[model samples]
Target: MNILIFFPSIDNGGPTNVVLSLLKGLNKNKNINIHAVYFWGDNDNNLDVINSCCDSIYKLDKVNLKSLYKLLAIIKEIKPDIVHSHCLVPDFFNYILSLCYSYKSVSTLHCNLDEDYINEYGFIKSHSYKFIHKYILMKINNVVSVSKSVLKAIPEVKAKTILNGIEELKTPLYKDNLDVINLLYVGRLIKRKNISFLISCITEINKIRNKKIKLTIVGDGELKSILKIKSGKNISFIDFNDNPFACGVENTFFINPSLSEGMPIAVLEALSLGLPVLLSSIPAHIEINDKMTDGVQLFDFNFESINNAIESMLIDCNNIGYRNKIKSQFQDNFSLNTMSDNYVLEYKLMLEG
Candidate 1:
């Protein structure tokens, strides 16, 4: 089976990680041939790994007629049995392209578009994106959402749920009973992330705890300069990294205090590394919390709750073999192996239909 995956871009983000994991997992299947194509976004960290997984890859200049024409040329050459795409532009083009081609189309809904666009572009454009997205969605053959929370943006569409996954990290590292707890946040710095809320919470947590909390935010964003100004010596920052774990995942409590998410891959990556995570009480994070008995905890945006979560994480992290238990659950459920199996089933459904 030949499968072609298209993305508007492949930057350092959750959706891109999902595509990379999908390619790697599906590549292992002897019956399958993978082709990965992207425009405008590049990842120095994962390009080689992505190259290893795909039968072929195309990194076009930008999302334009020229690129689309080039993509169509590749599709004509491969004659892929199914074409999978991510994000808005690729979703629209894949649907339009499928009209002239015989192959089926699949799109993964990576974010709550209504909430995402409202935060990124404001009221008017958010609705515009929503209307356009729903129209394009109706024309696509299959739609997949990373979490049920994301489906709220388009209740009319019967989108299937496929939990996002990542390949396991090489080593699960933990530094025990340290005087300082390393707190980590990774993702694009954007309005919806509300990262300032997180920095404030971490600042308040340090005021009362002897086991001091230090937040290491690993990503570049519009708010980087503003956030750095508000932060203190305890807070550190790294420019956007395709591999955030390179900063060191050891003895860290990964935290995502985002206002919204669609199965955040950074959270999944943290779990794979055996780092207990404290997440905001968003519907998406709650879904992940509900799946497990330990290692994942939900906290409100307030200082008290986040402080309590850190204390709880310290206790949990110190438990003998707790990291191993966390990594084990991640392997059994959220790993790329499981994600590929579920996606392959969806592909079969599309092909058989």
Candidate 2:
């Protein structure tokens, strides 16, 4: 079977990581031929990693009518059995291809489209994009969601929830003899992530407790500079690192106060590395917390709730037994192999139908 995966780029962030993981997983199947096409962004370090997994890779110059025609030409030439898309541009392009071709198409909804649009372009423009997005989603043959929250948000279209997965690290790292509770936030420093709320909570945590906590913010984005200026002495900002599991190992807890998410891969990596999580009560985070009851704690996206969650965590920061249990559960259920198997089954069923 020939499978072509499409994405805007494999530069960075959760969605890119998801596609990369899927590539790594699917490549293990000898019966499948893997091909990938990406349209935008420079060939960063990850491009090499992507190249290693696929039989062939295609990169288009841009996303325009000319580029679309070029992509359609390539699809006609390859005649892949399935075209799986990770984001909007690729999904739209694939949908158009489906209209003129005979290949099965699948799209993974990685975020809440309405929330993403409103955040990026405000209320008025968001409505127009939402309409366009829904139209394309309806046209696509199969839709997969990274989290149930994302699936529920798109009520107009039917989608299956395939929880994102990660490879488990062989040797988990731990911060030994830590004087303070080490907290970590690993993802884009963006408005949807609510980095500002995390900074404020850290500030409050430091002021109220005798055993003061420290937070290391990993990953860079548009809000990085502004967040650095607003952050308290207790917080430290770092650029995006390719290995979040390595960074997470030295921390006591993984915290994400994001306003919205689609089963964040960073949180999964953190849990895989045996770190307990303190997350906001967004539907995605809540869903994770529900599955691993002992391993995660949830709070509202406000100061009061975040402050309370931090205080609760500080009381038992050294719960090694609980952390280990969470890690075991995550390994059994959310491994890369499990996710890849599900996708392969889905691909077969789609083709058979």
Candidate 3:
């Protein structure tokens, strides 16, 4: 099977990681010939890993009518059996191409942005985004959502809910039971991440414990400077990396205070490493049952609530036994093999149809 994966850029993020994991795992299958096309400008250095894993790669340059002519030419050449696009823009382009010619196309919705993201990103308030997206789903052969939360955003659309999987790595050997508690936040530092609330939670937790809590926030973004200044003693920030699981697993606790999330892989990595998770009371977080994770706790996106949850974890650290059990369950449900196999199955179904 010849497959084409389209994404905006290969920059380090959840979508990129998900696609890379799929490409890497799927490449090992001798039956598949996978290719990746990205829109970002030429970056041979960034494309090295993708080129190594895929059969071919392409880039989009201009946005005018001429670009569409180039796109159609590329499609005519590759004639991909299955075109799997990630995110909104690529889906739109796939929708246009599907109308022009006969091809099996699939889109993976990574964000739960019904209207929130459109507004936040300054996209026109007009329902055009939804209209185009719905039109694509109605016309395209298949669509996949990374999480139930993401699925809910496009209700009634013909789509499958396939959870994103984490690459299985050797679990970290050391579990911190040191004097100072380690709090970790792993994700892009943005308003949606609720970094401010995380900082407030740390301050509140310090007040209750009357002790120093070491914090290591992984992932850089626009709010880096603000976070650094607001960070109390013993807190530090690290830039985002393609592989952040190891960095986050080093800490004792992983805090996800995001206002929204589409199956955060960081939480999964933390749980897999036996690090307790403290997640905000977002719909996405609720979908993942923490009772399965003994030490994982959920709280409203408030400092007091987060502080209480942290205190609960600090008080009963052995609860991590349950968290480890949950992590194992996640591994069974969301391993890279399971996710990639599901896509392969989906592709077969599309072809059969």
Candidate 4:
């Protein structure tokens, strides 16, 4: 079946990794055709995923109004069996196409579009926008979300909450070097992510324990320059990489003290690799902690809580029972194949209805 997948970019963030993995992991039985329309440059890195997996990829200048005409023409030609859009841009276009075409349409609300956040995004802040979201949710054949917290933000629209997936490693790494327990944070250096809070955690933790804690923050964003100037000892930053899982192995803890999130693919990947996670007590993080234990721990978005969690975990980093429990739960349920199969089923349902 032909499936057109729309998202902001395949170049950055958890959604990017989720999209690429899903594009590659879906059914081998079906004649799967993927149409990706993104808002970023079609660089070699981005095309690597598309060329290897998708049937066709288009990176249009999203800000250009004329692109809509071209986009409509392409959709009309593809005549896909189903259309799946991830964010606001695709949401609007898919609605437009649904009006002109006969194919079924589906959308994933990957983030919280609550009044608080919507207010910051211009005209999207209006009551009419909320109406449109509800209208689409009622009209669209199937609606899926990465986090229940995201769905809760828009209570009028009931949605199926499917935790994002990750591919587990066959051989998990165990590096218990006392000199350096590598702490990792994966995501853009944006305000909402609470990047500064991480630094505070590290500093406070060191003050209490005086242990060697090195941090690697993977991903660049709007706040990079100021963040660069502010960063202290043992903290480093890298641009968003498609292969961020490389860092998952041997990392003592995956830390994400974000103000908000959909289900974070990074945390899932880390847990899949048997790395313990320390995340903000956001609903998305709490929901993905399948073990129901503090193995996948949570703390408030503050230095005190983060420092306390780190210090407490340090005392038991080698607790075999805790590690095994986390590893088993992540591998069994959050595997990439499981998520892809669930999505494929959703698509089939849309086609049928």
Number of the predicted model whose lDDT against the real structure is largest: 1
Query: Which sections of candidate 1 miss by over 4 Å?
Result: 171-177, 208-211
Give per-residue CA lDDT, model 4, range 39-133, as digits (tens). 77545775686667777777767555677777787788888888888776777777777888888888888777763254335464655666666
Give the lowest summed-lDDT range of ten residues in model 4: 115-124
Which tens-of-lDDT digit does each residue in 240-329 have in candidate 1? 755677776477889999998989898998889877889999999998888766799889989889888877877777789998899888
lDDT (Cα, tens digit) per residue for candidate 2, span 255-342: 9888888889988888887777899998999888777856688898677787778667666455758767877889776788888889
RMSD from true fold, candidate 3? 2.7
CA lDDT, every model vs. true structure: 0.85, 0.83, 0.76, 0.75
lDDT of 2 at 134: 83
TM-score of every candidate: 0.94, 0.94, 0.89, 0.87
Better of 1 and 2 by lDDT: 1
Off by over 4 Å in 4: 63-65, 115-135, 169-176, 245-251, 291-294, 321-325
Write down the worst ten-residue block by lDDT for model 1. Answer: 171-180
After best superposition, candidate 4 residue 267: deviation in angstroms?
0.9
Q: Please list all clashing residue pairs in model 3, or write none if there are none.
A: 294-322, 294-323
